[model samples]
Target chain A: MSPQSPNTKSLVEVRELTKTFNGLTAVDHISFDIYEGEILGLLGPNGAGKTTTIHMLLDIVSPSSGNVLFGGKNLRHHREEILRQINFASSHIAMPFSLTVEENLEIFGRLYEVPHRKTRIEQVLEELEMTSLRSKLARTLSSGQMTRLSLAKAFLTQPRLLLLDEPTASLDPDIADKTRTLVREYQRRFACTILYTSHNMKEMEHMSDRIIFLNRGKIVATGTAQEITAKFGQRDLEDVFLTVARNG
Target chain B: MNGNRIHALILRHLYLYKRSLPRLMEIFYWPLLDLVVWGFITVYLGQFESGLPHIAAFFIGALILWDILFRAQQGITISFLEEIWSRNLMNLFASPLKPGEFLAATIIISFCKVVAVLIVSVFVAWAFYSFNLFVLGVSLIPFILNLIIMGWSIGILTTAIIMRYGQEAEVMAWGMVFIFQPVSCVFYPVSVLPGFLQTVAHVIPAAHVFEGMRAVITNDGFPLPELMWASGLNALYLLASILWFHHIYDVVKAKGILVRVGE
Candidate 1:
């Protein structure tokens, strides 16, 4: 039986999604459904198609042979409508460099057409604790501050679905823990689905309600942290990840 | 296309220009220097003016207008390139912002930059050499409009190429316009080019614009035929460039080039 066969209502249904680059398959015939409000952790070693999957979800990359349905509409046909309900952020992605922090947030907020934009911008800034740096140019921001700004932009839209790629990759341990807790709180408050990725197994174990383990463009395992560990008869998710990486 | 989205994109770029002094300098400095150098030549040549009464006016006027074309093209291409350099293209496209709206914003930004540069270039030319661009009178409006549209056509085509081929094609942003410069007859009449090149020049909108400017300078009455030709050519090229841009945008999305562009 397929992991996605359960009748849980899904906000995002990725059906047979595949991608190839110069004859090399980057994402190979992957299928999954992101539930309405559960946190789905996408786990894979480097080159295992994590980023490619995220890009496909965002329609930044088109699939070679399949379709992605966002909120029951084909992404190819209703990209703008579907994108309006979704927001994404990554430490790898940078906002405009020369624009100030406030300018960047205001611009993105307007693009998303958030209601009551001025009030929302101020609210997001206050939530992120970035009121002091609002005037600073993006080029002058430290990595941690930039990540926070990226988060601010993501939260500004108050999206129904949020895609976060390595959201805590650049932060210190304490902040990383804090951001994870904040993300959890926001997901509950907004009732938004989240698709998150990270290399830190312990962090993934703590935060993910369910996990998908991918290897070489294929999903090698799928279950909760405890279930996946039990499948490999491992002590923890870290050992289970090691076992998959070594044997797959 | 959404107006608010387009305005937001334009405002995003305006902040870059507003925050940096060097960027502002780049907009007005080069054109001013070009006018000054050519103004001195115009004065020196006026002493030997056995042919035309206001040869200096022709040189200075043509220089300022040529910069308008160059600036208009650079405005669109450079702004698009900056997004790639900052790795912000993915973030922008991932939003609800439509591709058409993004392109519209760049075109609007190009117009703003051209206007700013034009005012400064015209001011410095008049202050230094007393070469009044207003000498062309009401006819000057159409002349400027035609040149700016042609610049946008070239600008859209360059941006399309960079989108399809990636940053390796960036050099074309600065170099593409010049390929048409010699044939443009910006400093001379179309009659000066070789027979075949003149045939080639006739197809370019800029050639007709400069020819019309010379006619107005020589008090030959407004050349309606030249203006009509330039306007017609601009419309055709602008349509083709826009179509080509949409095609390239689809190709970029399919190939996933947007993700790797800045790298």
Candidate 2:
């Protein structure tokens, strides 16, 4: 992984973002910056606001008391302008099941207005090793193939800021490793900044240049994997996660 | 609104229709069934009364026009429900596609579906029962346009309700348009309704449209005032429904309903 420079630009600036449901606060007034060209892993247990934070960044969920700025423009005011350069993928979300793999990507490519859309779709499919599944319906794919297809969409636009929430949650170890390697290589090649969340601590350690740990809707730790491990007096990220999850 | 984005959304649904037999069959099934059943019923009634041909025209014409409204509304609502069922709403919203662009695409799709159903109904009505829909002449355009606009209004409002409330409110997609049917006077004159319902029917754009259709068939000259009222009411309802949808969209985003909408 490339070292993140202190002077590096922040691709996404989330300030005092909070989301409340009924009487429950899903995310508190937490603030963070995802520097350009760095893989920032958002670590949290279930219901710890990891997905909620990602949603706020994508503007899929509105923040109750704060704002998110992408490329120095407020997301609320410049939604389409900013979102054109950004993309998101999650295993929990899906494409039109009845549509074929090529058809789905064709739609998204046009949606993002990617120039030379046809070539880009073929390139993404080949890069994700999904060329064989191009004509197959999305509903016919296995869980692992579906995850790859979602990743293929994330990679399709070569988005500057890709927010992926548990993207590899359903993938097997072999494919999951390849996905991580592919993401790292893509970030290195394109200088794409990613805000990634996953339950796999080892994968988090392997992929992230910096990590933000959240618990109970608040930021608990922010550093490199080793730094967080030492800060929490734990052996590694998994132990640190356990410490936070059990104690909080 | 970007034209490319809107085209992409429409293309997505087109791909679905192209691939699925059941979905393709849906475009022709309901409208044809309604036309055939009503054609035979009108024929049966014609055998019993003298000069019932005009009455038969009213029944068949109303059936065709009412189907236009129902199909138009279904085109928008069912298209939205497809996204929900497939869990693809987030993908579209997360892209550069704006809410207006999304609605524009769906409205275009609805218009296309309405055209398809109209062609089928027009052909069958002329072929089977010798009842010509074109007898309404150029006034037919505005009548059809009015009903479509009203359908879009109701469809947009239903989509807003479902967006805020999630799948639990999906029943409204099919049922909501029917709620306006009685007041719409699709099969009878508004005067036959209760006094309060007659008053209610006056405000509905479809009600004026049906009344206008009957006047034209009965050689009552052009129903200018009725068409004017229908147009004015449609403008209000369409504007209000669009505004309501935008408002509910914000509410859904604020409450995080988008995350769990399909589930």
Candidate 3:
């Protein structure tokens, strides 16, 4: 059960969020809410605007016409404050290539104004078992190690809401499990809301408390993994994912 | 521009530049190569060109000044491409940065790159040609203003094209830049150049600055007062670049061109 409640303090609230690319619509009238401490999984296939949605949430891609509220305040009006409380992690986008893993972490930590940034960076490095690779350039890291460093940046601020995009998409089975355990532990330790997106059904089943199915550009279904499986008359979230993405 | 934010961004790019050993070497790499190749050519021609004292001095300053101004814009191309390669261009716009902040950082970083090339060219010129640019310098303020506005004027337009298009436009920018160089009084005095060519030289703002600087420093000629005139043109170019860039950014963004893959 989540320690933070829906009524406690909602961290992120999206109202009729819609993003249009030229004449075509990418994310069409999507709406959702992330409470103070809950793991909200956004699942969809390729080109489903999953990344675009995340971009909108992060205020990178402006919405065509909608409002995103963080802490009950408008994102457009209080972007600086809202951004300070949010951090994103992904393996696809690399940090400064010239800076070592540790240096990259320190720069972002300072940007977020994290208290005792070095101490926090070291803690996260150890937490992710990335302490040994801290001295290496971020560009030099193998995919798995770079993912860990990106995670380290995500957790550097221990943000109010952590947005992740298929973070373990390419990790080995062993490292993937370790990453899942780290996510669980991170949530337990920090009490921040986590909004994750992945196509890995098993990973989502294991890591998410609730999963949202996004198809085309709409939220077609949302429920706990078991509930979604049972309600869709499917054996697993993957089957339900196919049903929603293809049929509905 | 929020000086501190631009400072941070400049530090970020310069720091990244420092990390790549080959790249850092390349900063001095091409200009040094240019100096060696051209210096040898100049040596071969020095005896013949020496008869026209003003033309000879013009060649020396032009050699270094054009290299500085041109190489500075080179940094702009690489920096934007760097962001593109890393996919962090998307990430940067997500930050608390406006377009002005980003533009200012690009200009400042470009200026810093100019300074880097300046150091190398100055040292090499002093060593090889005994061409001390300091001895031939004008009022420090206008001199810097001239180079800065000239560089950024071109830099923004070049960057705007890159942002709107891609590396293909970069080659176009390079071609147009040098097209003006030959006619901009970089190699010979306006007087020596043919009538039509001299008119083209007079039209280029850099020609005015270069010719004026040569006149002041070498000929001890009457004050040219070209600064105010050149500044007017540069200011217009700067305004047009910023607006044109902003308009391109908005049009591309609204049309969703900025989000295209590999764009």
Per lDDT, the best of the predicted structures is 2
> Candidate 3 — which residues are off by over 4 angstroms?
A2-8, B1-7, B49-51, B167-176, B179-183, B189-204, B218-224, B251-263
Model 1: per-residue Cα lDDT over A111-191, one tens digit each = 989899999999988888899999998899988788888988999999988999999997899888878877888888888
- Point out the higher-scoring one by TM-score: 1 or 3: 1
Q: List each candidate's DockQ score.
A: 0.83, 0.92, 0.35
Q: Is candidate 2 or candidate 3 better by DockQ?
A: 2
True contacts kept of each: 0.86, 0.99, 0.24
Scored against the true structure, residue B82 in model 2 reaches a CA lDDT of: 92
State how far residue A111 of model 3 sits from its true place (Å). 3.2
> How close to the true structure is residue B17 of candidate 1, measured as C-alpha lDDT?
86
Report the poorest 10 consecutive residues by lDDT, candidate 1 chain A.
A1-10
DockQ-superior candidate, 1 or 3? 1
List iRMS (one decimal) for every candidate: 0.9, 0.7, 2.7
lDDT of 3 at B115: 85
Model 3, residue A202: what's the lDDT?
90
Shift of residue B261 alpha carbon in model 3, Å: 6.2
Which runs in model 1 stand beyond 4 Å of their true positions? A1-7
Full-model lDDT for every candidate: 0.89, 0.90, 0.75
Where does candidate 3 clash, by residue pair?
A: none
Best DockQ among the predictions, by candidate number: 2
Per-residue lDDT tens digits of candidate 2, residues A1-248?
43456578888888999999998999999999888888999998899999988888888899998889988899999998898899988989988899999999999999999989999998998888899999999999998888888888889998999888888887889978877888887788888998899999999998888999999999999999999999999898999999899988
